[model samples]
Target chain A: MRIEAGRASRRYWQDLWTYRELLGFLAWRDLSVRYKQTALGVAWAVIRPAFTMLVFIAFRKLAALPPSGVPDAILVLSAVLPWQLFSTAFSEVSGCLVGNANLISKVYFPRFLVPLAAMATSVIDFMVTLAMLALVMAWFGYAPTDKVVMLPLFVVLAACLALGAGVFFAALNVQFRDFRYVVPFVVQAGLFVSPVAFTLGDVPEAWRWLVALNPVTGIIEGFRWCLLGANAPFYPLATLTSVAITLAMFALGVWYFRRTERGFADVI
Target chain B: MSDIVIRAENLGKKYRISHETAQPYRTFRETLAKGFQRRRGSAHQEEEFWALRGVDFEIRRGDVVGVIGRNGAGKSTLLKILSRITEPTTGYVDLNGRVASLLEVGTGFHPELTGRENVYLNGSILGMRREEVRRKFDEIVSFAEVERFIDMPVKRYSSGMYMRLAFSVAAHLEPEILIVDEVLAVGDSAFQKKCLGRMEEVSAGGRTVLFVSHNLGTLLSICDKGILLDAGGCVANGNIRSVVKAYQQKAGSGEDLAPNLIGGPLKSVTFRQVWINGEKLGGSQFSPGEPIQIRVVGNAAEHLPEAVFTLSLYAEGGRLFTVEDRPMTLHQGEFSLQVEIPAGLLRPGDYSLALGARTAAELATPHDWCWGTDLASFELNEVWSANCKRDLHGMINVNARFTRENAPILERAAT
Candidate 1:
């Protein structure tokens, strides 16, 4: 058993590098396909959040909720920005396995690469949205806060959280196709549950812990707190949850994905 | 001992033949209970069918092997294992070099992409590097005869054009081992000839090839070694001709050719073994054009006479040139006819005979009773070539006069 494990591990290492080309190919293919026949092309990346920002502004002005960003401008832009990244990254990564049935069957690649490639392509969209966000911030003349130095760390945490959950959903999608439908619903619900538009202070004091337990809630609020410096760094606790959950979800996702991957070519 | 490139030991792959009929619209609870109960109670619910069992073989560098079998005979499954499309359920395989397969044309092609884009994508999928695809890119387009349509979208190309382009990319993209499955079966004869020439070039370049095809004639010319698989395992592994012979013999001997005496909806059936009669008829010698009794025995469960039928014979070489005629005039009962055996119709060889009984209609379902029993084995002991060399195209040999001035005129005027 010991010798077999050694050999298998060595094989896995070789396969990882050997399948790198496939990884790049899948990533490029997905990116090309996303904008292939579309009218807006790469601008769709900008349109989704830009329109969502407008909707948020209308809500903020109409309802008069306590403001997060620069009232009708920068605050809604920053909040909608991360929330869009979170939604797109996780969904694309999860849908990757089900989408590329052709590649999965004919070739031997690290199954994780399928979802990882989607996750990577999504970062391109994330970068574009981030670029747009910076422009929005400049337009509103919102200066950086001291906590802004820590914003990169929060973005990394959000990526990890998305990656970990993305892997699990990819595995589940293979076993049960209904996860495709479940994923959109989860993302929609997440938009409301996280403090995307409102401040966490609005929720009752008794419900604070339950609301903070949401990994993205902490990351989104952390994004606002670090960038704006209006709210306190509740991140110390949320960081613990995000890191711990990301680590656990990562390990679980890899294990589950590998276990189910053995049967993929045959069944798919 | 030309450096062995691939080796397999006790290689086997088993699949659970899922009887789709058994699983109905039952609930998950019911399915779980039934599955467990079936697993414990009856060993029959799950039948382990090994596509390949204990296959041990080695291929050296530059060897071409033809893996031949009937449908469901594990040919494709074995290719899948070697190509690493699926893992073997047991044992292991070791290979020293890369393997690529053209199992289906345009396998990795994106229809929305342009023909030029698909060429790169498909070429890479077959294990070719980008530089290699670029180097051979022009040659591939020219060979596929689709140079004009390179910029066009693949989805818009007709099926034939798509296949031609796909085949060109696959053939041009280099690999140490080329595994092709029935790709040559498509395309026009001229195009088939082109594909064969490309395969010959691949073989000459000292690359190993494993071609899976049902065309015995094609395989006999290309493959050096042959592997004949049946049901679950290799039955014969050796030279190409001998393996083909073994497969032919197995197919011929295993069938029950005799028509049932108590026939029903079956319009016209031959009771006697056609080949057995041919054997007893003084060993298959007939005057150039002679009258022969075409015998058939069947009862008219209901009388009808517009049941047109024809008896056909094909030599062991897959030649379908011989036919004994029974014109479209219905018959519903025990009937036999003496049809003329057109002189010089057959050449000297073993042949299998089959009979077809069809009713003439727009959407008529022809009652065909073809078998090893209806087979007529015959040989042409003498052929009066009559100052012309014989040809290798079709089944029947025809006799005609050639007038010098009219020859070219006839050729020009021919339909």
Candidate 2:
């Protein structure tokens, strides 16, 4: 490998692949450390989304919104699962660089893997919650179309959206720790802005486009369509827009992260 | 793909020191304020500080090279660049093989994780693959001697156990090139010996090693090549002995390098000057088996019934032995005392002298009227003899007579 003034080594991506086991170990470490001290352990994964589903069910009843013909609980959950995954992954990715300051400053690896490992931890939590989602569906006697097979694709989309924004913020956090405050504000405010509690159809048609700009909007809608089958709403243009925006954010995140990554060890 | 495993060319690193704030990181408010100031025609209050500049070196496979210098001499910056922990601002470095650096031990260890789990986590952070760690797992655990606590959380282990476990994992790593800095100073003497032995074994296996430490003795024993950095530049490089000699000479000279003789007002006497062999003492080499005289010149403000003079000899910063002359009455005036070390008392090595003076009554207490540590440093060169090998280990040497005796032998009776 050649280390030069202005560019990372040409083998950075190859090194990233070669160090895949590190990615796994780091993610496993976070997961293990996270659960080791907690009273509920991994059960928190299931409990978190389950509690959010309950809150949305009460909101649905109080708002007296039009039903989309599917079970009210399943409707909010399909979107909530993807939304929780995106939010958790985003928060983890954004703050990971500072969180692993010891590793970043002392060792040499593809530093991007630090945030990527955080995403992996969230992905593991999402899997556990997905299992819980299935059990909830069974409890509600709801079985859907073969479209559920395509569910993994939407999951990937949510991951891309999370990683793209997370990487961008993670890099920013390293420079100006002020982003530490900005990140939580973005995640908390994001829940209400995205269609987690209500379907996209509930919004006034004139303001729907603005809501779709969140990038998570299209992925969550796609998730609902995949789970709710023919009864759920599927907007191809909005879904396509979310995919495009997610890809752009992913590219932009990586570009900004790479431009700033070299100085991380020095400043962090 | 020549024999050289690493090469650096004209490397440099520059950091901007902002006078506005001493914090290592900038906050959003400071950045915003700076932006407004830029618009108002105020020049940025920042100075470019080059921690390292125009440095170059190369190392071949199996070369154990030592990097030595005073503090802030760019020793760490140079190592950080070589290890790719940070990038150099100018020039470039090329490495022909995989490199693993241990700038610190247990860098990624989690206190909540058990020792067994941490081994895997720490190994991966140090660039070892899961399969590699798995294969060497037993060896690492046994080497650390924490077999009974492998499943226990590392936070529960004693600090010694932590260091042992950390060092053991590093010792088992098989990177093509290894870089380490000041880690051996943590463990006990026996553990340090084991670590030094392990390092020797690593070098023997033909792996390139770059090491930095303040212990000159350890450096001399392990490194065949040396690079001396002075003020961010390479002053000398080549054979370890000569580079070390150059460093010692540079460190030994200068105005403040002289003996420290300042004392409190409670003292009635003080050593104004010291000499060796009737010459002003300085950093110089001396031969063994020669009568070496250290003379101390001092003045007494009042008469002391019983004044004692003492001199201590130290090797590598550790006191080797001390001698005291018989107490004698002193008049109120200048007085001088001389202590001579007779022949065949010291082995070939480096040493320093500390001078002390006190009344016999004060000698019983820790208070000495006149005291100065490291008043002078000298080296004893090896003198080849017809019957003895040169450079025999230990601090002091003595003369002994060997004789053979003939006697009657007694037979053992079986019962």
* Index of the highest-lDDT prediction: 2
TM-scores, each model vs. reference: 0.79, 0.86
Task: Report every candidate's CA lDDT.
Answer: 0.69, 0.84
Model 2 Cα interface RMS deviation (Å): 0.8
- Per residue, candidate 2 scores C-alpha lDDT tens digits across B1-415 of 4898889899899988889887878998999999999999899998998988888888999999999887788898888888888999999888989899999988899999999999999998898888999999999999888999999999999999999999888888899999998787667767878888899999999999999976666787789999999888888999988887787767655433333344443377766666666655545667676878777777788898887777888665356788887888989999888788886787777667777767765555664466666556566777835333334556666566887669857788987
C-alpha DockQ of every model: 0.25, 0.66
Give model 1's share of reference contacts: 0.11
DockQ of 1: 0.25
- Interface RMSD over true interface Cα atoms for each candidate: 5.5, 0.8
lDDT for residue A27 in candidate 2, whole number 0-100: 88
- For model 2, residues A153-236, the per-residue Cα lDDT tens digits are 999999998999999999989989999999899889989998988888899999888888878899999998889888877878
lDDT of 1 by residue, A1-268 (tens): 0111112334765776776776676677667767877888999889888988888778777877865435456766667767777788899888887787877776545677788788876788888988898888787677768878988887787787777788788777765666788889999999888776665766787887787777777777777777666633454666577677778888887878777776676665
Fnat for model 2? 0.82
Question: Cα lDDT for residue A160, model 2?
Answer: 91
